[model samples]
Target: MTKDTPPPPANTEQMNSPSFKLAVQDRDFLLSEPMRGVRFMLEYSKAQILLQRAKIRSTIVVFGSARFREGGPNKEPFWYEEARRFGRIASQLGGALCAEGGNHYHVIATGGGPGAMEAACRGAREVGAPAIGFNITLPHEQQPNPYTTPELTFNFHYFAMRKMHLAMRTKALVVFPGGFGTMDELFEILTLRQTGKVQSLPIVLFDEGYWREIVNFDALVKHGVIDSADLALFRFADRAETAWEALIEQGLDVSVGENDEDLARDM
Candidate 1:
């Protein structure tokens, strides 16, 4: 091999092969079906790391319809404004606005889409508080709302992992009117509570009339599908402040700006 001839191009084909690409750098390899488990882990770990970095200790999850609008049909605007109010009130009183001891508590969390999610995040934004948006990729619902803190917003491909992240750190759950997806989430949480799968969570369903008309709790008890005592798993509220008061009465620890031993222990 002469120095001027460059050794016959040094067999560039081998180096350029797809298999020679680093595993982490190989998008096709990482996205393949065989790496699904790895993708799940990546989804889980990425959010976990970002949340930890933000010092978000707990969250108040708000689930509601993504279809509602400020001036659309029915009481859409009312519900939207109430959700916004709830977000603002909760952030102000629930320790989200205060990062005491390097930890933020009961920060607002939502599905990271339109309607109620947007309202809640907007409220947090209006109050200058950080909120979380756990967005899932879908053909109809990929764009995240504009209000969630950019650093704290996350995207996931797996619905199970998204649900896990939503459920894990929630201190309280406030659900507004929604369709099938929202119902699925609400029931799963109720089932988890019914089966003692998780710690006690304060659940408040907004709009008592709407929910009662939608799902007859009395009928369920009459049919013996669910125990009558199970009815106590969640309460109903018609207004935003009432919902906040209900959560407080239901044992949500609104003790803000405290680095108490109990809070630390829970952390």
Candidate 2:
């Protein structure tokens, strides 16, 4: 290389990149003091709204398999109509309650991928209710569907953080037939509630037939593997109305909004 020519920059192989190291140190400094990197603007196309203190009345998170198609076993496709129905029902249930109440409205939120996520967002849009799609960039065949409300949609890099956000605002959970990802989300929430790490929230597994056949909760109870009382952790519903009724029976108001005070208390 000529004297004026520069050598290629050294590649740092350490797990924490130089930028990440600096970011962490900066964050630690801010935590101890304050106002350190306050001026550092994030390059994210959409900024995350940290509504930690915002009162959220009720949010329903719907989970299902992304690979399900539009028809059933008898047909050629599966999961398509099922996801659509799940979304449609959740939207109606949330919207009806919100309309009856006020701005403290119900919201339908999804994982922000296709399949059931799109169905949930589409259902909310169909009813003119606000919905949230929590998008995450994954290396696999996942992408945020176009049906999510632009203003309410959110993207995150951290699964734990995304899961935390889901738990933070969730009032209820509806689990549809899904794969490992769905189970991960579902069990995480269940463990949170079961361990009292988070507040008790309603969890409903839709499609009683499939759920019962796939996993036998009753057997768990019968075998004394788990306490029968623990079975009360979640409810099973065959349809949307049943799921809505289950939430209501728990003395939950779907249209409640969060106030500054409520948010502060939770935070």
For each candidate in turn, give its C-alpha RMSD to the true structure in angstroms.
2.5, 7.5
Worst 10 residues of 1 by lDDT: 258-267
- C-alpha lDDT score of every prediction, in listed order: 0.90, 0.66
lDDT of 2 by residue, 122-233 (tens): 7777766666778776876467778777766777766766776677766678888777889899889988887888666888887787778777888988998778887888
Model 2, backbone clash pairs (residues 3+ apart or across chains), number? 8
Which clashing pairs does model 2 show?
55-258, 56-258, 57-256, 69-78, 69-80, 70-80, 71-77, 104-255
Tell me the TM-score of each prediction against the true structure.
Answer: 0.92, 0.71
Model 1, stretches more than 4 Å misplaced?
Answer: 1-10, 99-101, 257-267
Worst 10 residues of 2 by lDDT: 39-48
